[model samples]
Target chain A: MRFALDLIESFRMAIDAIRANKARGALTTLGIIIGIVAVVLTLTAANGLRDTFRQSFSAVGSDVIYVSQMPWIMMDDFFNYRNRPPIDLKQARELESKLQGRAIVNPYLGERRDAKYRSEIMEGVQIIGTTEKQLHMSSAVPATGRFLQPFDVTYKKQVCVIGSEIREALFGSANPLNQMVKLGRTEFRVIGVMEEQGGSFFGDGPNFDRQITIPISSFVKAYGGRHGRLNVDLAVKAPSSESMEMVEYMVIGEMRNIRKLRPTEDDDFAINKLDTLIDTFNNMMGVVLLVGLLVTSISLFVGGVGVMNIMFVSVTERTREIGLRKAVGARRSSILFQFLFESAFICLLGGLIGILLSAALTAVINATLMPASVSVLILVIAVVVSLTVGVVAGFVPAYRGARLDPIEALRYE
Target chain B: MAVIPEIKETTLSLNAIDKTYDMGVEQVHALRGVSLDICRNEYIAIMGASGSGKSTLMNIIGCLDSPSAGAYYLEGENVAAMSENQLSEIRNRQIGFVFQTFNLIARASIFHNVELPMIYGGIPRGERRRYAEEAITRVGLNDRIKHKPNELSGGQRQRVAIARALVFNPSIILADEPTGNLDSRTGGEIMGILDELHAAGQTIILVTHEEEIAQHASRVIRLKDGEVESDLRVDDTDACIAPSESLHLVGGATS
Candidate 1:
């Protein structure tokens, strides 16, 4: 009960002290506010990116694995994999028949190109070249018309499925079904408008919403002349009954056999999964948050030093008051807590203001650009960090105040 | 000498108290082998020149500082062995101090200034408020409870300081030049309050260099060159207490 009263008294005194030196206190808190704001804004954006990433990757189907030329997170030198052979149309067809019951396989690839409808042009729209099975494998359902048919691939028909972003950019509000749009130099009839896939795994490049999908044969016919070697990515969807590990094991074995790898030779092809991308994304996010916090904390360190300097001045200015308190029976701990609480309260106030400001800014950004929201965990962490900074910064000065000799202090003019 | 009534309890005893200050190359002796005893309800004045260590003696008595070499007893407890925390508790519970400058917290209200000691003593809110108000009323500053020290006159500020000292009901009220900063008239007003407190059975040790201030106490001890030069008791209608009491003073100092 007495401890509680002491805390209450200390808090009251702290408030009074802060209020008395409003300008100095506010100036000291400014550094903390700027630091917290930077940290919060960066972390909030990172958090939003992580959330968007999970949603986008989950939409790509968690059970599906990709067979590509290079690993998503490259474990070794890239030059070593340059000699590996690419999986072509013939290999995809053979794998389809070989693994019919175990999985649904779809070979696909994409390149950035301009898509045009009349006068409207959408630049950097991903032109995906894939078979009919990608509609199920990629979990992209047609929002308007039908997806690509098997005939479209086998007969090399000029038919395409556009994403919502391409639909909006090229056709605006017009009915896009059967409307012809130019993918590179080839004009293809829009068979379907795919559902809105709003997020990109790699933040800026190749958003799913801005893609146009056509049959692999039509893609080869349209853009095959531009590149000498076109590597097709194979997407394999495993059965719900089999665990991903089991699926991965079977896929690895089949891939090695098809590539004619010796028992001693390492498998040349890389089978990448969504989890690999997710892990790499997480690692990148960690670095972003770490660098942001580290840089901002330098400002916070300056702020903490400011607090310490001001506290020393405060103690010196109130030497007589401290002496009087001591003479009247205040313990050393009481004096220590009083000053410590003052600095902590100042930092906490700055942190709260920073968070509130960042939250407002984040809301504006979410409305104007990307989707972002500050989480409760970040709020708690920000508060804890401010308090820790305050305590650490306030220690030496408060110790000096606590240890002031009453006789000498009282005698000080 | 007149007979001193030995009926009341002894509140303070300082035996062979010595204090030294190391000024780097030279050692300055503040108090050398000083001993004294004070009983309940005694209004004693300690008198000395500036370098005679009267402040140091007051500090020791109030448990603010320990004697360099001596056993100082307060209410039969050996105070020299007390820890800093214990000394703080002793200062809080047993000694009330009044400074020359009325050392009240300048930013706090008169009521809060008076309530401070009780707050340190961990007295509950209701009791502390009541005691604070009563002390303020006793010092006749009932209307200025909400006023800060700067908002009051010099005499009123001293009264607030006195009320703060009284609110804790300590064993001794140690006033070091309580009226030093005030004009004679205002100083008299403060002295009147002390007189009233002493009349109501409060033990007070007033430290001052002025003979007029020392004359107010029932007993006076004069120090010179770090040793007591004279110890005397005042009697009614006469300056000094009878010769037998004077002999006891000599006996007490020598023995």
Candidate 2:
């Protein structure tokens, strides 16, 4: 009970002292404000990026694994992966037959080309060549009309499915269905238009809504076997997400067997899961968060030093007052807590302001840039960090004040 | 040796208390084996020139500094051996101090300055306010309770300090040159408040270098060269010599 009362009294005294020197208090808190703002914005930006990545990545089916010639994240010995043989259409077909009835395999390849419908032309449009099973292995769905039929790949039909961006770019308000558009040199009719899917946070990943899909036979004829190199990536969808690992092992085994690699030799093809991309993304985000916090912490350290310096000055300036308080029966802990509370209160004020500023910035970001919002967890972290900084910064100066001799302090000029 | 008077309950007892200061190259003895006893409700003055150690003794009595050697007791507790926190508690609950400069926090209002001691004493807020108001009223500054020290006159500020000293109802009010900064007329008024508080059964210890201020106490103890030079009690019968003549005679004899 006594401690509670003392705490209340100390807090009141701290507030009084701060109010007496408003300019000094505000200036001392400025460093903390800048530090906290940087820290909170860094965290909030990372959070927004993660959220955006998750939303865009959902379009890539989680239960599907991609068989390619190289790992998504390369390690040392790039030559080892570079020397691996290309995964061709023949190998994709063989793997599909081996994994028949257990998984749906869709082999796809991509090329950047210009698409033109009459005089209106869209440059650098992604054109993906895949089979009818591509729809079953992805979250993509046609907004209107039907998807590619199985006979389209067998007969090398000149029909194609276009994304919403392509429809908007080439056809604009006109009916795009059955409209023939020239992809590179070949002309193909738009049989379907896929729904709009947003881009990734980094803007580096494929813009799903700006791509068109055609039959693999036609794609091989026009784009594949250029210099006898055909690198086909097989999208293998498991029966369930839980069985993805088991199907991955079977695909690896089938690929190794089809390639006729010795038991001692490593599989030439890389089995890439959605988890690989997510993990890589998480690792990259973790580093960004770490570096951001590390740099921001330096500013916080400088802010803490500023607080300590000002507290020492405050202690010296209030030496006589301290002496008077001690004479009036203030315990050392009371004096210590008084100063500690003062600094903590200042930092907390700074932290609250920083959070408000970050919230405002997040609004601006959401309105003009990517998705960003300040979470309750970040606010809690910011508050805790501010308090911790205050305590650490105020400890030495407060301890010196608490240890001051009342006689000498009272006599201080 | 002074003749014994009627017996009374002792409020403080110092037994050969010694205080020393280490000034780097040399050590200065501030108090040398000073023994004294103060009774409840007694108004005593300790007088000495600069470096005579009266301030040191007052600090010891107020529980601000511990003796380097020997024992001291407040009421019946062994104050010399108490911890820093315990001494602070003793100062908070049992002793009130009015400094030479009136040490009221310049930024605090008169009410807050008076209420400070009780706040440290852990009094409830409502009770603290009541006691603070009562003390402020006792000092005859009820209207100036909300005024800051800088806004008040020297005499009013001193009165505020006295009110702060009285709010705790401590065992003793230790005033160290309490009116040193005031003019004679204002000083007399401040001393008059202390006199009234003493009459109301508060034990007051006044430390001063001025003979006029020392004369207000019933008993005066003078220190010279870190030792007690004389301890004189005023005789009420000899009104003319009681205030000045007898005190000088004793001082002359002792020196």
Candidate 3:
């Protein structure tokens, strides 16, 4: 009870002192504000950036491996093997044949196209060509209609699946299935429509919501590209979690054989795991956060120095108070605690305000600005750092104030 | 250690105490073989001139400074060899002080200043406020409790200082030139308050250069140069000058 009372008194005194000298306290705490603001803003930005990446790689499934033109996490080996050529479509097919019952292999072809239905049009939508296996590798799912089947591509038919965004644009109130849509200059029947994919996180690359998909064989015929020069991605599912390494090895050997590479020659292919991508992005964010914090800490250092200067001035101004306290039976330790608590309180107050402001700003961003997120973990860290800054800055002045002699202090004019 | 020799279970004691200051190569003696004793409820004053070392002697007696050589006892305990921390403890728990300038925190309320010592003593929060208010009320500044030191009159500020001193229930109240900053009229009101406290058996040590201020005490000790020139007991001494009636405030008799 006594301790609590003393602390309350000290806080009251501190607040009164600060209020009495409004300009000085405000100016001194400005440095702390900047420090805390910097910490909070930087943390929020990093959090937003992390959220952006997490969403940007939305098509990368958590438990799935995406084998394409590049590795998800770039290693020294990948850079060192930069001379490697793009993995071909035949290599994808051969890997499927070799892995037979052990894996689920799906091949895809992406063709850039535009479409219109009943005077409704969507520009720059991709006409993706892929097997059913490709659907499970991404976070995408069909809305109402079924995905393309083997029968749709068996005779190189011109049937297509339109994404929900295209369906919305082309057919407002009607179901898109069985509806005819113009795919570039070619006409195709829409057999399926996808669900709305929120925030097109693949950003500007290939917005699935604005997409339409045709069979791979039909795309090859319609686009009329080099048949052997396939613009395709192969997604191979391992038999189980434990089979991931075996699946990778099996695909590599099959690709080398299909590409007819000599025993001494290096083959080309990029295998990407969702976990590796997540880890790499997180590591980069850690480095960015570290650098940001180091720079922002400069303001905190200045704030600490400000606290020191202001506390020194306070000591001088309240010299008689210190003396009076000493004369009243206040121990040196009590004096020390009181002064320390005052300065610490000042910094903590500033820091908490800064954090709240930053949180408010982040909340606004979360509500309207970015699809990415800032975590509570980062907020917690920033608050802790600000508090430590205050405690450290308070020590010197508290010590000086505590050490004053009652006689001299009281006698001070 | 205090200069006044204490009684059995009483507060304050001093025995043949000596104090000297080293002025570089020059030795300036402040007190030489001086002895005094004070029991609870005694109101005494020390009178001196400009260079009479009264202030230095008061500092030693208040435990704000240690004597160069002396055996002093406070409440029957030998304090001559007490540590600085111990001296501080005694000063806070056993002695209250009032200085010449009122010495109230300028921007603080009368109540705040009164509570300052209690805060240092680490009193419980609710009780600190309660005692501080009571102390303010006791000094006849209850209505002015929230007023800042700057807003207060000289006598009122002194009252607040006295209330602060009295708050902790110290063994003795030490006043060092307590009336020095006030006008002659305001000074008497403060002196009256001290007298009342003394009447209530609160031991007091008043240090002053004014003979009138010295004469208000039950005993008067005069210092000359660096030694005690005279020591005697006197009663109704402020009455020696009846012209002080205009300065006395509240219920005390006209001086």
Candidate 4:
């Protein structure tokens, strides 16, 4: 009970002292403010980047695996990966037959090309050449007309399905179905329009809404053969998400058999999944978060030093007052707590202002660039960090004040 | 020497107390085997020149400093062996101090300054306020309770300090040169409050260098060097004796 009363008295004294020196208190907290702002911004930006990655990778289908020439995140031995033979259309067909009953295998090719309709032209349009099975491997579905049919691939038909972005760019509100559009000098009729799927902020993954889909046979003839610059990448979807591992093993075993690779040799093809991309993204974000916090902590340490300096000055200026308090029955612990409370209160004030400023910055980021929001967890962390800084910084000066001899302090002019 | 009236139940006793200060090359003895007894409700004045160690004795009596040798007993409790925190508790509960400069925290209101001792005493806020108000009222500063010390006159500030010293109802009120900073008229008014407190049976030990201030106490103890030079009780008719003659008489009586 006595300790509680002492704490309350100390808190009141701290507040009184701060109010008496308002300008000094405010100036003392400036370092804390800048440090808090930097810390909060770094955490918020990491959150935004994570959110963007999650949204972008969602469209890639978690249960689907891709067979590509190279790993999505290559480390070393770049030439070894480059030397591997491309997985061509024949290999995709054989794999499809091998996994006919267990999974849906779709092979596709993509390249950036210019698309034109009437006088309107969209540059850097992602044109994807795939078979009818492509619809099963993607999250986007045609919102109007119909998707490509197997007959289109069998006859090498010139019909195409455009994404929402392409539809808006070339035809605007005009009916795009049955209209002919030129894609890289070849004309094809637009048979469908896919629904819009928003792109990721980081642009690290495919943007589904900005692509154009055409028959793979026509793509092979017009763009290039499998032996040309275009490589065939196969997408294999498991029967169920829970059975993904089982399907992956089966696909790998079948690919090894078809490629005639011995058990002693390493598989030349890379099996890419959403997990690999997500893992790589998380690792990169971890490094960024670590570096950001490390740099920001330096400023916070400097801020703490500033607080310590000011507290020492305050202690010296109030030496007589401290002596008076000691003479009037105040314990040494009471004096120590008084100064500690003052510094902590200042830092807490700075932390609150920093949070408000960062929240405003997050709003601006959301409005102009990416999706960002400050979470409750971040606010809690910011408050804890500031209080810790205050306590650490105030300790030395407060200790010195508490240890002062009452006689000498009273005599101090 | 007048009889001290059977010692009247000793409230404090010091046994050959010695205080020394380390001055690097040679040690300075502030008090050399000083011993005395103070009974309840005794208004005693300790007088000496600047280097005569009266301040050191006052500090020891107030529990602000411990003696380097010998024991100090307040109400028969050995204070010399107490821990620092224990001494702080003793000061908080048993001793009140009024400084010549008034020692009121300048930024605090009169009420807050008076309530400070009780706050450290850990009294509940409601009770603390009531006691502080009563003490302030006793000093006739009820209307100035909210005023800061800087806003008050020297006499008023001294009264506030007296109120602070009285709020705890300590066993003894230690006033060291209490009116040193005041003009004669204001100083008389401040001393008048101490006189009233003494009349009300409050034990007060006054330390002063001024002969006029020392005359207010019923018993006066004079110090020279680090030892007691004379101890005398004043009779009403002998209040105006010449300083040299009074000292000679008191010196003869003590010897």
Candidate 5:
């Protein structure tokens, strides 16, 4: 109880000391405010970027691995990747046959084509061709009508599932299911409309909501392979997120066997997980956050030095006050705590303001730029940093003040 | 550690206290072999000119400074050899100091200034408030509890200082030229308050150069060149007037 009272007294004195010289206190805390703001903004921005990537990648599906012509993060050697053999439906079939009962493979191919219904035309619509199994590998779920059936793929039916955007653009308020939409001179009956998914990511590419899907056989019949081979992306789905690595290894070996690659040769195809994009983005942001924190901490250090200088001046100016307090029975430790509390209180004030300002900035950034979040952990770290800076900066000056000789201080004019 | 000397019926005793200052190549002897004993409820005054070592002696007695060579005891505690923290505790619990400049904290209210020693003594808030108000009332500044030092006149400020000194109910009330900053009329009012406190059996040790201020005490010790020139007890002196009557005279003069 006594300790609590002493701390309260110290805090009151700290507030009084700061109020005595408001301008000097404000100027000294400016550096700390700027530093904390920089730290908070950096953390929030990085969190936003990570959240955006996670959402986009989860939209692609976490349990699925993509077998593509190149890595999702892009290879360092562009020429080597460009010259590699393309992924095809043949390779997808071979992998599925070899891994039978172990996994599911959904071969996909897409083209940007204009979709139309009556006189209305929606240009740059991503039209994908895949088997009925594509539904299992992706997060897409139809909100209207029914998804494609195996019979549609077997009979090579001219039926398709329209995305939310394509449905809105071509059909307006009219029900899109059972309606006919034209794609590149071919008519397709719309079987379903997929649910709305927000925010296109992956370099701002068109999202799944802006695409339509049809069976691979029908797509082959409508648009025959112009390069004599079908260029496809085989989305290989594991039983669960935990089994993804094993599925990836199985598929890589199957693909290499299908291609008849030599033992010493690097695999000609890429097995890309949705998490690689998140990991790469995180690594890049780590560097950015480190640099930002370093630069801002220098300013915080400068702020601490300013606090020390002010404390020195305060001690000199309040010499008689110190003597009077000593004469009244204040111990050396009490005097030390008084000045230390003053500095810490100033830093804490700056940190709180900085946190509030950064929260505002994060909101603005989320509205205008990208998604951002300020976690409780970041707030805790910011507070701790400010307090540490206060103690480190205020130590020497408070010590000198504590060590002042009462007699000499009292005698000082 | 040096053992404390047993001295009965004594509130303060300084045995052969010596204080020296090293001034570059020369050593200045501020106090050389000064010894004195003060008993409880004794109102004593120390008279000295400048460089007579009275201030140094006062500092030693108040536990503000340790003498270079001495065995000083306050109520049988070996104060001369005590640590700084111990000395601080002694000052907090045993001595109430009234300075020449009326050193009340300028930014604090008269009540807060008086409450300072209690705060250092770790008194609880409720009790501290009660005791502080009582001290303020005793010093006749009950109406000025909320006023800061600068808002009051010099003599009122000194009263605040006195209230601060008495708030902890210390063993000795040490006044070092308490009336030095006031006019003769206001100074006499302060001296009259001291006279009332002394009459109530408070041990009062006052340091002053003025003859009139020294005349208020029953026992007067004169110091010359760091040594005691004379120690006289003027118990029957006519100047030691009754406090209430003197206060009445002061009121009439002021009005």
Candidate 6:
């Protein structure tokens, strides 16, 4: 009880002292606030970035696997495997038929091709040449007119569904329905204008809306000049998350069986799933967050240094008071507790203010842009780390204050 | 000298004490064979010049420092062997100090300064408030309890210090040159307070270099070169002695 009273008394005195020097105290705590703000804002943004990445990658759905000649990060390995022959349109059709009714496999072909919409020409449009079923598998619906029908793909119709941007460029308020649009060296009728696709694994940087889609058979017949055989992509949509892995394995098995590869030989083609893109994003975010934490910890250390400096000054100025307290019934623990409480109050107050400041910034950013999901775990960590820094920085000065000789202090003039 | 009545309760006592400090192999003696007895109601003054170890003696008597050799007793309990905790408890419960420079916390109110001891005494806030108020009232500063030490005059600040020392009701009130910094008039007023406290049966030790301050006590111990030169009872049992030059013959100013 005596010890408790002593601690309370010391706290009261410390608070009074701090209040007396409001500007000084605030200046001392500014470092802590900056440190905490940096840590909190960066971590929260990183969390948001990670989430956005997941949502964008999963926009294509989980069961769907991408078919590409080269692996994403391991694209260097693609050069070594350049000797392998590309899978053509016929092989995709054969695989789709082989899958039967169990899973829907759509033959997809995409190329960074140019489009000439009269006076304005857009380069590097992702000309996704695919069957009507491929569009249905990814749950995509065109904004206007009709998507390519099975009859159109079989008859090799040159009808193209123009993206919203492409529609604006070619017709500019004129109805694009049945209008003939030029795709490189070919004339294709614009059957539909696609709605906004919103987001993708890669950002809509070059504008995905400024693209055109034609039938895979039409693309092979028209754009297949030097390449002769079209490198087709197969997208398989499983019924649910549980069946996704099994379906992927079965598709690979069917492909292996089709290629007639022996058990000892590796599968010729690559099956990239949504998890791969998600994993890449996760890895990127981990590095970003790690770097952010390193920067945050440096600032926290700077804040801790500021705290120690201020605490040392406080101990010196309050020597007589410390002596008086020591002379009284105050134990060493109480004095230490008092100083620790003072330091923690400064740091925690700074942390709370920084949280408010960061949250306000997040609110503004989220209002103008995408919402940043702040992690409760990160918030807890920031606060805990701040207070711990305060305590650690406070310990030596507190010990110094508590251990001052009462008589000598009283005698100090 | 006739023996004074012993208050064997031993409010303060010391035996064969030595305090030595080393400054680069030269051992400086701050206290030497200092032995003294203070009863529960004795008011005594210790007179010493500069470097006479008066401050060291006060520190020992106030339980601020332990002697290099010998024992100290506060209220019949051996204190020299006690830890800092025990010394602090004694300083809180048995002794109250009034410093020459006042040493009042610069920013605290007069009441808060007085409440300091009671705070250290581990008195609860509610009780501390009441006791502090009473202590301030005792020093006739009940109206000025809210004033900071800087706001008060030298006399008032000393009174605040006195009130601070008095608040805890420690049997022994230790004053180390308590009126050294005050004007003669204000110093007299402070001496009056000490005389009053002594008369009211409080044990007091007055540390000073001025003979006039020592004259107010019933007994005086004079120190020179870190050793007591004289330990004597006041002449004719007078608590207030005139200046030694004989004011009547010299026609000194009197108020």
List per-model TM-scores for chain B. 0.91, 0.89, 0.86, 0.90, 0.88, 0.87
Q: Point out the worst 10-residue segment of candidate 3 chain B by lDDT.
A: B238-247
Superposition error at A306 for model 6 (Å): 3.9
Fraction of the native A-B contacts that model 4 recovers: 0.52
For TM-score, the strongest prediction is 2
- DockQ for all models, in order? 0.67, 0.65, 0.46, 0.57, 0.43, 0.38
Cα lDDT tens digits, model 6, B69-122, are: 887877778988988877778888888888877778887888888887776677
The lDDT, on a scale of 0 to 1, for candidate 4 is: 0.88
Fraction of true A-B contacts recovered by candidate 3:
0.79
- Give me the runs in candidate 1 sitting further than 4 Å from their true place: A51-58, A73-76, A109-126, A150-158, A168-174, A179-188, A199-204, A217-230, A240-242, A367-369, B1-6, B236-247, B250-255
- Candidate 2 lDDT over A194-267, as tens digits, reads 98887754565767888999999989887776667888889999999999989998999999999999999988
| lDDT agreement with native, every candidate | 0.86, 0.89, 0.77, 0.88, 0.84, 0.78
Candidate 5, B-chain TM: 0.88
- Return the lDDT, model 3, position A209: 74
Give me the displacement of residue A243 in model 4, in angstroms.
4.1
Candidate number with the higher TM-score (4 or 6): 4
True contacts kept of 6: 0.48
Give, for candidate 2 chain A, the lowest lDDT window spanning 10 residues.
A198-207
lDDT of 3 at B43: 79
Q: Flag regions of model 2 displaced more than 4 Å.
A: A76-79, A200-204, B1-6, B236-255
Which has the better lDDT: candidate 3, or candidate 6? 6
User: Pairs clashing in candidate 1?
Assistant: B1-B242, B1-B243, B1-B244, B1-B245, B2-B242
Q: Which structure among the candidates has the greatest DockQ? A: 1
Question: Could you give candidate 1's per-residue lDDT for residues A1-413 as a string of tens digits?
Answer: 66667777888889989998899899888877876787788788888888877877656787888998887778788888877888777777777777888788899977888888899988878899998988777677899999999999999999999989889888888999999998778899999998997667675645778889999998988887687778888998888635778878888888888878899999888998887888888898899889887887887898888888888998899999999999999999889999999999888888898899889999998998778998998898889878888898889998999999999989989
Which should have the higher lDDT, number 2 or number 3? 2
Candidate 3, B153-215: lDDT as tens digits: 889989998998999888889999999999999999999999888877688999988888988
Clashing pairs in 5: none
Task: Report the lDDT tens digits of candidate 4 across residue range B1-255.
Answer: 122444466678888899999999999999998877777788889999989999889889988899999889897799999987888788888898999888888778999999998888889999999999999999999999899999999999999999999999999999999999999999999899999998898988999999999888987989888888787867432222323444565667757
**Candidate 3, residue A9: lDDT:** 64
Residue A358, candidate 5: C-alpha displacement in angstroms:
4.3
First chain TM-score, candidate 3:
0.83
